[model samples]
Target chain A: MRRIMTGPNVVLWLFMIVALLTGCRGGAPLTSWPGLTVAEGIVYVAAGAKVYALEADTGNQKWEFPGEEKKGPFYATPGVEEGLVFVGSNDNNLYALDAVTGNQRWSFATQKPIIAGPAVAGDTVYVASADSKVYALEAATGVGRWEFTTGNWIWATPLVADDKVYVGSMDHKMYCLDAESGQERWEFEAGGGIAATPTLAGDLLYFGAYDGKVYALDAASGQKKWEFQSGGWVWSQPLVVGDTVYVGSMDKMVYALDATSGQKKWEFATEGAVLAGPAFADDLLYVASEDKQLYAVDAATGQKRWWFTAQTSIFAPPALADGVVYTCSQDGRVYALNAGNGNQRWVFPRTEQ
Target chain B: MSQVWNLLLQGMVNSLLFLYDVLAHNFALSIAVFTVLVRLLTLPFTLPAQRSAKAQQELQPEIEKIRKKYAKDKEKQTQETMKLYKEKGINPAMGCLPMFLQLPIMFAFYQSIVKALANTPLQMVSLGKFASPSLSQLVPLGSHFLWLDLGYPDPLYILPILVVATTWIQQKVATPPSTDSQAASMTQSMQITMPLMFGFITMSLASGLAVYFVISNLVGIAIQYFITGGGGLLPQRGKKGK
Candidate 1:
């Protein structure tokens, strides 16, 4: 018995050593960043490998999809449309679930992980994947209609506007495709990768790129009208409100630019990288930074009104609705704050005694 | 605990980014440079470990004699072995320092590569905190290098095979031979199994990590060759020919 146990013990020791060496390779819990979506009094959040629906008023759990046997983490915000919740999972599946009941309606599998939320049209849902393909799927049946392959991964959310689909790719190109057929209309190449969704205001399109520049393009022709360069990569989606475009950069600065000429109107500096897009409500802009502070600044003047400190880094954009703002921190806690004063109203997954 | 880990991770990321910048933004070249740099930095500990291993190998015959003399009494065998080791100025514990030091660095490099080649918005956001102002502009670093996407697994299986081959060669060259037949066989089995296991792991992880492993193993083999005067695992022309 002693002789038999010796060999096995050596093997077990080796196994433990190997395990220690490779243990860090395991998947980390997805950062509860910006995967919060609020619609019709329900706040939908994706965290801990599941999609959760919480009562917006009370921070109570309403329902959770995929209660058990979760395939992967959710990094994209859930797109709620017509009683259906659409979300992309790192499992490489785009799932459409019933919003109220938490039942899986349908799921379409992609070749690679889906990191961007689906853009819902009337009957079609468009999503981009790390497989370097943009897929248009049937909203109800989960059947793929068409897929357009790019030169590299597509990490930006698809924007469906003016009967077309616009998406940015890590290939440093912005593609305008026919929404119905996935046919390419035009492509505009940027100096660096585009990882942020492009925002459309009137006839112009505004977006930021890893090239450290914010671009204003003519929506119809994919022509660059003007570009404003920043000190760092612009990963935050540009928010346009009445001739001013507010965008944040990893340089720890937020710039408000003129919508037409790309002229910098004003810029606000933070202590750390600004990862979240500015949330505007009641003429106040809410911006979260990795500095662990959520700053409420004057949208027009770029002057800070107030700032609230969180327990950890805030990477997700604050969602503003009904005089309340919702944001998530890297510490896995969600905060509901008064939009006007930046005071915490309540926290999700309430602490235990 | 997590805060310390985060800081370590950030340090590794910053080191890699700095190398990337210095190497003209070539990701693969940067990894090669970083591997060489790490090997050079750990030379002090590795050299002592190699010397100790050589001393242990040289004393293998004496150790075997002691084992056979006290085979019936296990406690006496252990005491005699310890006495022999101490008399010969051999510290078995010193031989493990190099490996122990490398374990954390290997894990940290894996994490740094994963974060540097982030493919999603959430990953990019998480990476934002560790990125310096200049390096942040390189977010979503280009993964293309020859036939591999650094961020994804190697599709051609080339990296996994190379990693296994290099790791096997390095282990064979670095591990000293034992006098006991059973111990020799066990070491031989581990020499084969460890590489295969790591090959399987490399097949699933990002190809950049596999690249790092290949380079690191190659450097280890070269270091072993220099320390052992090209004696380990090398073809002995005179003895073998006779």
Candidate 2:
């Protein structure tokens, strides 16, 4: 029927059209792309040309910031601290967005692409560029604090803990730098490229290398605590919670190891590869796989608790908030599911542009 | 198995293979070949879409009159519209028949590309990890295009530019004339905005999608020429923009 377009109706219609376009039969943009980041009380998702700030607890959209239509196809998850969100773009720049207003604060230009998301600590924001440079910028003004050089590209997110910043390099080295001065404290050579970030717990640091080992190093001295080997390369970041460290190997197995000793705890196998980091919430560890499964495993047992199979493989990590797990599939579907049961809550369809 | 179901399944498989073998391996060739194949596969609906689009365009004046007459009467307007469509042997759905029919094919295409090129494993065809001599024995799954990986956007941004240019050409050629002023305005805006938006996306995320878009647009142009003797269903002007 040809309905009369009232003000509310017009708004509804616009929403419906957007809903239709978003719910089109092709690929859902929000869930298909990897721009989901959770910080403070907001969950920021970069979909198409907009960045949406959603209430983390309620799963409701709070605000949507209209971004440049021709400049940024933003995939970097926003890093938030002190009322500001820092993110990178394919435009070869890092943007500091107001955490509340979603307004652009200031942007820093980079030499090449900034694929990895920005990481913030205290007054400085650390960003890894595809151009093989790790930059530390002043969080307030987007001014450069320091830029550290690496041999090859730096796509891994830089993690800062205990006054040290850890980053992996395509140059086959894991460089530990002093967070304040940006001086290389130590660099460990790997058999292959180190493309994943290191995780810190207590005095121990956990990270993966192309050498196929999940290495445990002392955060203070960079001394090797232990190294646990896997069959294939380790691309996914390692997660350390309590006494266990969880990581996925290109060998198609998710391995759980002792965080302090790097001894194998238990392993769970899947059909495909896992490139995204695992999220630990409650007693469950949630991981997205190229096998199209979001597996929730017992954090202590390393056994699969429940698995939700998506129509397409998920290369991006699944974000968990409230009681729901959010993830995207190559099938172009963004799904919200009950974290405990692995039952589908809602499926947003994909639309073709 | 049901006849329609079989067709859908086979169509999905065919699209997957063609996208990998033809599109990624040899893009231009794949686009041309697949466009024709797709057109021919949906050949049954082409005539109907053409007939419907032409009918819809022709009925615009009459439809506008009816809309004006019953503009306030939502139910009456709908009934009148349906009645008119029924009386004229015009299927309003005809224009979308080919596209609707191609849904399975499109899904399959997305699946295959994301799996094969995006480096996801769920839809992986398992092309048996081949050791490439150049890049340290890595199992290259045919996702690489020149120096940039199709799965991720290139830092240099050469592919995204090509994507925008080709997309603009395709949009300029394929967009149909709109009788409704609002629709026309929206269409115009979309034609300009979509390419720019997608160009940014390609620049940001995956260049492979841009490759797919470029090939798809070129193929679409070819399909239009082959089937409708011009630029698909859209009227061919002297130059694209006008």
Best by lDDT: 1
Collision pairs in model 2: A24-A350, A27-A350, A28-A350, B224-B232
Candidate 1 structure quality by residue, lDDT tens digits, B1-242: 88878888898788888877777777888888887887788687577777876677677788889989999999999899989999987877776666566556555666777788665565676676687655654556666799987877888999999988987787667665555668677767876787888788778777887788888788888887776533336742244657
Candidate 2 residues B158-209, lDDT tens each?
7678777766665544444556778667666765775676576666555555
Model 1, residue A67: displacement in angstroms?
A: 3.5
The TM-score, computed over Cα atoms with residue i paired to residue i, of candidate 1 is 0.79
Model 1 DockQ reads: 0.24
Residue range with the least summed lDDT across 10 consecutive positions in model 1 chain A:
A1-10
Worst 10 residues of 2 chain B by lDDT: B128-137
TM-score of 2: 0.56
Q: Residue A120 lDDT in model 2?
A: 88
Lowest lDDT sum, 10 consecutive residues, model 2 chain A, at A1-10
Error of 1 at B148 (Å): 6.1
Residue pairs that clash (backbone atoms under 3 angstroms), model 1: none
- Each candidate: what lDDT? 0.79, 0.66
Q: Report the CAPRI category for model 1.
A: acceptable
List the candidates' TM-scores in order. Answer: 0.79, 0.56
